[model samples]
Target: MANEDRPRSKLLTRLHLGTDEPLEVVPFLDDTGHGVFATRAPSRPNRIGLSIVRLAGIDGARLSFEGNDMVDGTPVLDIKPYVPAFDVRHTERIGWFAERLGQLRGKLSDGRMR
Candidate 1:
C-alpha cells in the first residue's frame, strides 16, 4: 500500500490468470473472433493489469479498500493516483462488454483461468 493519502488509487498489477508465453495475433482486423486485445480478460502477453479502487481507510501499514478485482495475494506492480484528465474518456461504443452490462451486478469470478 502507498504511504501517502491517495483516496483513489489505481492498482497496476500482473494478473494471476496471465501467462509468460508470447501472444499469437489474429490474422486480420476484420476477423470475427474475440481478439485478445479487444477484451479485458486476464490473459495477456505481458500479464500487466489495472484496477481502479477506492481507499476506505489507512492505518500504520494496513489499508482498507473497495472495488478490488484481483484475488487475494495479487502482486501489485505499481500504484498511481488517478487523474481524470488523463484517464477519463467519452465514448459510445464499449464493444463486447456493453452487451454484458446487465449481467455484471451478480457476477462472480469462477476461477476458470487460475
Candidate 2:
C-alpha cells in the first residue's frame, strides 16, 4: 500500500442528541459515505447540536468545532473537509435561507457542509 491511497487529511467528530431523544446508531448502520448523527431527539425536529467539537489543523481548517457545550453520551460519526471553491454556491439564488447562510460559518459537525 502507498501513502497516496491513504487519506491526506482526517477529521475527529462527535454528534449529539438530547436526553429526550430516542434513537441509536448502534455500530452506526446505514452510514452513507460519511456524515454526522444526532444520537438523541430534538427539542424541535430540526434542532441539532454539538456536545463537543475538534478539527485537525494540518489541512487548511479555519476553525476547530468545539466549546460552549458538554455531555457524555454524544455520538460523533465522521469528518470531511472545507473547500471554498468547490463548496460555495455563489450564483445560486437564496430562498428563505438566503440571509441565514452567514450563520453557517459557525455551523458544522458534517451534515451541513454541502
Best by lDDT: 1
C-alpha RMSD values across all candidates: 6.1, 13.2
What range of 10 consecutive residues in model 2 has the weakest lDDT sum?
27-36
Candidate 1, residues 18-113: lDDT per residue as tens digits?
Answer: 654434432122234566677665667767889998787879876666777777777888888888888899999988667667766766654454
lDDT of 2 by residue, 1-114 (tens): 343333332333343442333333221222322211423223323444433233323346343333423344444444555444555567576443454456556554444212
How much does candidate 1 score in TM-score? Answer: 0.70
TM-score of each: 0.70, 0.29
Error of 2 at 94 (Å): 2.1
Our tally of clashes for model 1 stands at 0
